[model samples]
Target: MRSECPVRAVASGSGGRRSYLVTGYEEARLALGDARLSKDTAAFFAGVDSKRRLHPAVAHTMLAGDPPRHTRLRKLVTGAFTSGAVAGLRPFITRLTDELLDRWPADGPVDLVADLAVPLPVMVICELLGVPETDRPQVQRWSAELFAAGEPGRTDAASYAVAEYMTGLIASKRLRPGDSLLDRLIAARDGEDHLDEDELVSLAVLLLVAGHETTTHFLGNAALALLRHPAAMERLRSAPDSLPQALDELLRFDAPVSTSTFRFTTEAITLGGTEIPAGVPVLVALGAANRDPRRFPAPDRLDLDRDATGHLSFGHGIHRCVGAPLAKAEAHIALRAILTRFPRIRLAVPDERLVWRHTRLVRGLDSLPVLT
Candidate 1:
């Protein structure tokens, strides 16, 4: 689309809503940080359709709010994901990665998505949130349904299930709290400036889901990328220190989030010489922007040595993913562990036979079969 028009309006859909898609790298970057484009879905939809309402647990999150609300909610959880905090969890992540890998069979094909990628992040996030091991299986199921595309009924059910689960969990933590992040958040509620029940539940659900989903897909995508590019895999295996840089290149090559969440235009804005009307929705194509030739030389080629500093994988601006540091830490540890454990691991099936999940919000494999 960049070749034609970076910012182009899509024909009105069934709802007769006009939306804009930003495909160019520069346009997407600018649009992502632009305050003129608001993330307050409630306010945007209030006048558009009064009867339509989202679940409180889904609506009142930092992801769906703008400015003041976003600022406050983000402040409460920001400290937990800071570099120092993530650094402290490195030992735990490394140990967890080893433990998960150890359970894999000594000789056979294994689904990396199910065996490693999914569980690693799920367990890490669950531990951080203080979810008991007994409840993790159910939590994982609900989270999976929440992200399933084209299934409104299942999505709504999952949302309600998660809200109920978190609400109960929060109540439990109130009586006997621990040092986990959830406990600290509960403590925050007792303070002078505090989170309400809805906000607290919403934030918890957001963390539980977002904390793991991105990294889950990222690991799968990164593994597939390495398998396809033998030289890149060899480079990382030969020099373990290069894994970090290679990860960035891998993310840019195949972003986990194909498109960003909705951002509505607060006022008429021009992007890439195209003026979009106010109140219209805008979708930034993160995957496309990352591969824009104008921004990166030989954009499609996986160059681990190249500096992929501006990739929009985790997004840009204030709403950029807060879990990025932890995700990277987990991915780095997990990827390194996988490589070290199975030096000759390769795809069990042909590349074309692999199936991707049918979700628009997340880009991931349904299963990554590989021989160890």
Candidate 2:
């Protein structure tokens, strides 16, 4: 796979265990979509010393759920992010993008990550969760540390802080409810669908982190691809309809989550001729599968014109990202606006100097310095 993508796996695993990394497209789909694999992270979750700091519950989102529970959690929020629902948010999203652009520097380079990518989604998510705007920065910080490596105690502290904050918010919502998603959720009943406080807090945190972090990475990545490939960016700038197609390719070529939230093996399964023992954890390489040559010719090269919709940036089947439509809308607005406003946008720093978060599950640069 390395010959095809950035990371390669030999048909081997440690301890001469005859382990093999499934790199092909068919194998990936079979592994992820099949019922034999589990989404529970309990195997590793228990073994890992919380030496790195993560709120136990915060680590488990819809990403870590399966079956009836997964259905419940996802159903409560999916309606808010469907095509029609996300379309409803367009006016607000456009206004937000415009406001950010208006404040952007007119001449020199600016870090798009800070100026646009970070706040746009963060604000949208805050609104969705009914989180106070003033609390967003703090929420964003906590979300970052929960997943970020390199710091130990800090990640734990941040996790606890977020948990505490959510706990307070949930308590408040229980009393004085408002006309927001959170309020509706607190009042939700699907044959008595009310969530326990713990469940409610868990969903709130999931949406907060997933809603912003993943979409922000998409914006940053799409921008990076355009900046690197001038012609693709220009084509998008010239043809408005091309934006959607280009976004598809960008998603395929540079998936945000390098791997899906971890999945465990339920029963012994043979993948790539290796038997993954039941209860073992396996990471889905979405990025690697996105570039599988057997599935996409010239897979590594970004082609805005290609049919790129089948990419697994969103996991397949029932586990597909619930917020996909909302995310796509944001990406279109963000990228189109960036291209139109700054047709001459280009990387301000040398490509080699750009740094990526080595510990992140999602793939994105720390700063996207661009001349606007």
The residue pairs in collision within model 1 are none
lDDT per model vs. reference: 0.90, 0.79
Quote model 1's TM-score: 0.97
Candidate 1 per-residue lDDT, tens place, 1-372, comes to 877998999864586677898899999999999999999887886756543234679765779989888999899999999999999989989998998898888776899999999998999999999999999989998988888787777887888898899999999999998999999999898886588888889999999989998899999999999999988888899899989888889899999999998799999988899989888999999999999999988998999998997899999999999999899999899999988889999999999999999876779999999998
The superposed Cα distance between candidate 2 and the true structure at residue 150, in angstroms, equals 2.4
lDDT of model number 2: 0.79
When superposed on Cα atoms, how far off is each prediction in RMSD? Answer: 1.4, 2.9
- Say which candidate scores most in TM-score: 1
TM-score of each: 0.97, 0.92
Q: Residue by residue across 208-264, what tens digits does model 2's lDDT show? A: 888888898899998998888888888888897779777878998999888777676
Stretches of candidate 2 off by over 4 Å are: 2-20, 43-53, 189-191
Q: Quick one: how many clashes does candidate 1 have?
A: 0
